[model samples]
Target: MTEPNSKDPAPSPLGRRERLLLAAIAAALGLLLFQLRGGLQPQAPLEQMARRSLELPVALANGRPTILEFYADWCAVCRSMAPAVEAIETKHRGALDVVLLNVDNPRWAAEIERYDVNGIPQLEFFDREGQSVGRSLGGRSLAELDAIATALIAGKPLPRLAGVGSLSQLDVASTPVAGPRSHG
Candidate 1:
């Protein structure tokens, strides 16, 4: 047989252009898949639970009104009330400070006592002057919490929170001990 003509080619698995196109397709598909996978993932909970909260010292010295919330991971009431409280925190933003104290942590034992927090989901309201304006307990609705905060901010009597365990001003003379150390 004669030598192969220039136009005649030996069998090859892939031509250079074919391989390059294949690689480009693979790269594009990989990127598309990556983007799709990322988009499918769920977003982290936001404004449904307190994310960043004030520490005890900052809250004590904030000069702004505060809501000291005692909660624990296992407390059902605390869990149920988280969303409502979170909404309140978001709505009030800079006008108010919400401090979260995990009762499960020993660091807040002093605060647990100071607020007379025998049960969870307790709220202790402190005014700009660091005075204990009032304390409320149990799973309060968003409306109730909002009303309470508004009243506290306005220095008005708290709107009646029916079924709330306690909602009354603290005795100025009977000051709570130095606030608990924060885990924030």
Candidate 2:
């Protein structure tokens, strides 16, 4: 204590072990925050199905029954139905094909028009021979979806459900109804 040596440094309040512990805690908190910020979170069901979906052309030509879902990222009904669609896809991975087309994506504009997608989440069901069998025009419960999938897989008629209808081509002349407000 003889006037402490000039070269001596002051001791840190925290010991080396304490500092290490603090650093570890800080790192853990940072990681947790990153996860909370969605950096490490699992993908949403819609995104997961989209990522795993096969192309429309490929799915159509694969000699398997196919389900085409027209959806948009911002569509709440579509998001709500994503989990059921995903489950159907997973459950019929080999026997059937599930394809997702985002309505917001310009690449699917032709399909959007082809399918007459005035509203979503529209689902078009195709048979093994790639023929359009039926279409569902709105969100459906899991049981309804599963029933549809099961019928399609078994080559049976789709279950009779609201918003569900068989698809077919018709040859007829059409004319727009003339009205004061009609643009056609």
Candidate 3:
């Protein structure tokens, strides 16, 4: 090291106060990134959605349009799509009946077979005449659910869904659909 030259103007190392300010700025950035992580992923349960379990034959016999929601308690897609489904129910109120069928529950085993419910979050629609309208599998956006419910109430053609297969009145004669992964 050379002798100290107090008169010479040179860049000095960061003082303790400066170091602390940098650390605080870095910590704030870290916190911001952490918050952004949550914003990046698909968020579920938009609101506390209200749904009710149902008995298939009885619910269908009520002489109203029915939407059978096949789900399992452990299913993430079911949990997430819940608020949207509830919105449909709230939208259609008296004219439509929303049925919650827990696939894991033995009570709904027969319904599971009748609908060939291999995937969770399946939204099955039935017209007032007790005819099958269509069924949507996997995750569905709020708009999709809204469309289906609106169409169902108006007796219009149900919107076709992608990623997961859907069954319409015209396609009921086709073969059944098998295993499909659920969403979160």
lDDT of 3 by residue, 81-182 (tens): 777777887778888888786555455556777888767777789988879978777878889888887788788999876777332221222323333443
By TM-score, is 1 or 2 better?
2
Q: Is candidate 1 or candidate 3 better by TM-score?
A: 1
* Clash pairs for candidate 1: none
Candidate 3, residue 184: how far the Cα is off, in Å: 26
Candidate 1 per-residue lDDT, tens place, 53-91, comes to 878668768788888887766566676677778888889
* Models sorted by TM-score, best on top: 2, 1, 3
lDDT, candidate 2, residue 109?
64
lDDT of 2 by residue, 1-184 (tens): 5787989888899999999999999999999988876686564667668778888888889899999988866677787787888888888889999999876655666787788877778899999888999888878888888898899889999989974433222211221233556431
Backbone collisions counted per model? 0, 0, 0
User: Which candidate would rank higher by lDDT, 1 or 3?
Assistant: 1
Residue 145 lDDT (model 1): 86
Window of ten residues with lowest summed lDDT in model 1: 42-51
